[model samples]
Target chain A: MTGQVRTVDGRVAGRRGQATRQKLLDCLSEMLSSSPYRDVKVIDVARKAGTSPATFYQYFPDVEGAVLDIAEEMAKEGAGLTDLVAGRSWVGKAGWATSEELVDGFLDFWRRHDAILRVVDLGAAEGDKRFYKIRMRILNSVTNSLTDSVKELQAKGKVDKDISPAAMAGSLVAMLAAVASHQKGFTTWGVKQSELRPNLAQLVHLGITGKKPTK
Target chain B: MTGQVRTVDGRVAGRRGQATRQKLLDCLSEMLSSSPYRDVKVIDVARKAGTSPATFYQYFPDVEGAVLDIAEEMAKEGAGLTDLVAGRSWVGKAGWATSEELVDGFLDFWRRHDAILRVVDLGAAEGDKRFYKIRMRILNSVTNSLTDSVKELQAKGKVDKDISPAAMAGSLVAMLAAVASHQKGFTTWGVKQSELRPNLAQLVHLGITGKKPTK
Candidate 1:
């Protein structure tokens, strides 16, 4: 659905140019994963991509612009995260399973795109609207689905009427994201992945269903 | 008791020297608040502090070392957050109040130091040990207290025997922190601050006690 890829100079990128652009992005992503965001420079990225800084500028305005390109792509893929909670059951054993799968899937997604996500998070936190918009796009998918689930349960008089579905869903999602980002910290603190997952799932189940999971 | 302050060159900082050092830190903190972390340079901070780059170098190795100093100071103050949860009651109306107050205090602290916290979060997520340690030190006080609370509840046969107190406490604290950092995001997304607090408190209360708050 994205329009034709174009260079910063308003020229449509042909097949060869697109390949070069993608290569630059791949190198940039790798650099981001390995180095501090502040230290990444255009010349270094271009060198790694077997090109010059001029070519890098041809494809994008600057490092931030190129990073935005990468984040947008990840956000598109992150939209599928909606399925992790959408139309899921929140009753009995099925409820526990749903929560478990949701946590597992969400953590996996964050780990996969963590480098770009971290940059997006920092940018958004620093009050950049472009970054904030991308962060919202990626998170809104899961948050909206979870909110719907809470609202449905509330409608059936299962969850408390006083609950704010949006806030609950938002908080739960934020917890998942935070925990996912700091998975290494938990491990070092002596909580194994095996135990961590279930406890997190239980918390999710409790947050949504307002009752401890039977499992 | 901490040792006497020393400069990078191993000389003990005299009163005037310490004043100059602190001024550089104050300028760095202000620059961090107003600009992107990547764009903050030693020269700018020195200029803002009415000092030369050579004078700045006398105290700090670079911009990052100076930032670590600021973060270290903040972490020391953050140790006080322990009182928010330590020995607090988690029963009936008191439990709900505890949860609300924890959320309130944590969010306020995050807002107060968000600029530095954002940098620390970015650094930790990027796998820097020093930043990770600071992040842990700041979160540990409350996480440990909550962990003890859960374990106490479990020992009394109040919480599920299967619950891992550490995991539950870590998850709950992580949720609080993530939500705190993104308070602006929530308000922008239509969750008012007033409704946001109680919903978050409910989630915290439920995660900790495995039951909806009576409030």
Candidate 2:
């Protein structure tokens, strides 16, 4: 009975630790929303989280590590929808259903997290090598999804069978990435998101359907 | 005749100054190709150009200025291509022909300047706002070209009536920028230019044609 109480106590402590860590991350995200990623410091993050420097250190080695953790979390959230479609078979109704759902879901996902997506997009442009790795991981996730969709389309005779799946997959991923980057830069160029979204959706639809809309 | 000789001498001196500046930019590009942009120093660029630091300073205020000059040169090259395509109508036969020619020509241009492209691409990501501005300038050139194409298409009733030409132009420009960024990361990911070029072309084609090719 004593041993059981010790295990329960340990579980509660772990949960509390996790809660603290998450609170810190949430504070960091809030801070980053209004400032450039490079300008934010560890002290700022710690103070904002209502935690001591020592507690911040206990959770993250440095500000970059914390930012990287947030970046990875954002990447995972954006890539999760794609991963779901990548694991499915590439033929029949299940495959088609998955492909359409994933594509539509990804569009919505990018729109929802446009701010964090802007951060990650700009972060990938950093001269650091790790940014490239993070970017490639994100691209790979999108690539896997595109590959599954392309293969399924080809199998169903919906897409050009002559085009290589890998090439099509790469193209789709590239297109989506471009759309995301443009969304990030819209404000600077005096563009509204409402004005950009329909064009982006039209481009995606054009890529898959192969039919140019008649006026 | 004596006045003509003096004028010729002045022209010769001006030409020599221009050549020296070009040589410095060439040297900087070479140095950046083998190293990160942030790692490059003014002394290294001077030594490579076979000039003194004072001479380098005469032309550029700092390393960032020199980088910006090189980026401007690239933007001019990209813009020159658009100027070449501006007079042609982008409808029916001319539309398909102009796009194919442009894509093929661009692929060849990127292939020839892969080293310089890599340096510019890296520099843009290295937190140099000037480099980023230059990249934006390049994209604007592409945007202008697409805008002209869309205008021509709309005049002929070839494009969708609902989509604004400006939005379509933005999307095409974004797509190209994405392709360029992905191509820049290719070597770091063990992907080759030969493997990426065709995919990039297909992506451009997809964006322009609004048709997925049937195998």
TM-scores across all candidates? 0.98, 0.67
lDDT of 2 by residue, A56-140 (tens): 7777777666777777777777566666456664444554454455555665776665545555554454335665667667777
Candidate 2: lDDT of B98?
A: 60
TM accuracy, model 2: 0.67
The segments of candidate 1 whose C-alpha lies over 4 angstroms from its true place after superposition are none
Cα lDDT, model 1, residue A82: 96
Candidate 2 CAPRI classification by DockQ: acceptable
Cα lDDT tens digits for candidate 2, B94-204: 555665566566555655555555445434443346656666676666677777767666677765566656676776666655555456565565556565555444444
Whole-model Cα lDDT of every candidate shown, in order? 0.93, 0.61
| Model 2 lDDT, residue A210, Cα | 43
Candidate 1 residue-wise lDDT, B1-215, digit = tens? 88898998899999999999999999999999999998998889999999899999999988989999999999999999999999999999999999999999999999999899999999999999999999999999899999999999999888988889999899989998898889999999999999989988888898888888877
Candidate 2: residue B41 lDDT (0-100): 82
Clashing pairs in 1: none
Displacement of the residue B188 alpha carbon in candidate 2, Å = 8.0
